[model samples]
Target: MILEIIIEEMSKIVSTIPYLVKYKKHRLTLDDLSTLANDSWLNDQVINMYGELIMESADSKVHFLNSFFHKQLMDKGYEGVKRWTKQVDLFSKRLLLVPVHLEVHWCLVTADFLKKTVILYDSQGIGLQKVARNIVKYLLKEAKEKKQSAFEMGWTVSSNEEIPQQTNENDCGVFILEYSRCLALSEPLHFLQKDTPKIRKRIYKELCDRTLHKKG
Candidate 1:
């Protein structure tokens, strides 16, 4: 399933960006789509650190949870995410980019206030309707906790299949990081698998130079 998605995205990239085929031929040729294996943050420390840094700089309200926060929320339910949101003005938060780990792979779900929607971004091609529903449920629970009976799940819930994909197993972590980066800035899903190498370097440069919010 993941390989099929990667191939699909690769074909699109080749057609859209012809020069990428010359810069890195290996990107269009890797084929390691075996059994889906779960990766750890320890092995993927750089990816997690980039994700955490972006999440930390996102807002003072702590609207989104990333990396280890997934386990906390999955274990403790909506109250887990709410614990952080309560520290600041929850209603004032414009967006929340929660990195959700589904089984072995990683994906992202955004609680977008500007669009009044919950958008799912999965690079593996699997739609995350159920995951988006859970976030909506969490929002309702959060509203109720604040003594607001008017909260509802009427916000839009959808998935974006157009983002980048990994040609192999290990790159899912990188895809999650890129997903958070793009969505946090409210940008369109313009990145592709070919951008992964550059993104990995960009993370280090951004951290070193302290220039994450803008393109250089």
Candidate 2:
């Protein structure tokens, strides 16, 4: 019974988010919530309790919420839906799982092919600082192993102290080495612009050596 109430309250909170945003004109009324209950795409199951907290918090920043929704929609393959109302409803349902401290935002950068970007803003207050650092390291390691560009892939943590903004120069943190267009076949990796030929060659050689060693 508790779980059921949580789901019901979550649904109401999510359905009302767009209206609560600064840009939205129409206030989410009882009729609006009823409309959401009737939607088929909205997920009724509550998978994560932390996500439910993020969705319900009125003080939650926009960026974190948006990022969570964008990832959820993309993972579910619902990015190409034609109707705005449906998309909004779907977004609300997916956003219920994000932790409240991370300010998430999603934007449709290009309408022609449905290119969406998810931005996450981490306030310096919570325990998110370490999580952000870990994410950066993981992304960098993955890019290096795959021979992908890591330049464009980066994150920013806002805090009171003088935090290191440049990842490449920091020893304790991760650095993104840029790649050249010639090296990147698909969408340019974020760090493609910062890599030199020497660095690329060294990485390639190390990867090849590791592969050969594994096979041997």
Candidate 3:
């Protein structure tokens, strides 16, 4: 997926935000430039808007797991995932588009059911081997109940290297969003850290014009 193509198109597209956030009540002055983004922005902008768009445009079955759903699995175990899985058709959705928020950092994890592999997308360009393993464990337990015996619980996990790396801590969430958007569309990531300003603006415009509702 060409990042430029998506950004360019979003610049011209009119969108709405269905998800809501607390920051909407507060005006963001120039003083807030260096401040980190809140969870509302990350949840709404990255997962709700961008993630939903990726799934809606696809012909193949893609499942967009919300950050809340991820929290449940990460903290509450397989029992928590069981409840979330019941809300969607799991076995049919081969592409599990999960955006994981860990210790104030963001990472994208793709459980390719068909490929039987786990792909971690971190803009920091770091290996989250433990996180990958945790995902596989959850998937293994999940697959059992779903009767997906073909899915290997011990799947190979990998992450990208050429993707942009964030020097600043606040942009990790943004990178996860970009990574998910590109990987969901099967596009090669061409973004870099220097493009942060452009990336932020691109997504800001998208939030203003390309969303369905305000979500947080």
Best by lDDT: 3
Instruction: Estimate, for each residue in 21-123, the C-alpha lDDT of model 1 and write its tens digit.
Output: 2211111122222111132221233444455567556654335464566567668887667767656555567777777777788888888765668888887
Model 2's lDDT to the true fold? 0.25
What TM-score does each of the candidates earn?
0.68, 0.21, 0.72
TM-score (C-alpha) between model 3 and the true structure? 0.72
Best by TM-score: 3
TM-score of 2: 0.21
- Each candidate's lDDT (Cα)? 0.61, 0.25, 0.63
How much is the lDDT of residue 3 in candidate 3? 36
TM-score: which is higher, 2 or 3? 3
**How many clashes (backbone atoms < 3 Å, residues ≥3 apart in a chain or on different chains) does model 1 have?**
0
Off by over 4 Å in 1: 1-49, 55-62, 148-150, 209-213
Model 3 accuracy (lDDT, Cα): 0.63
63-141 per-residue lDDT for model 3 (tens digits): 7777676778777888977877686766677688788877677888888877788888776666776777778888878
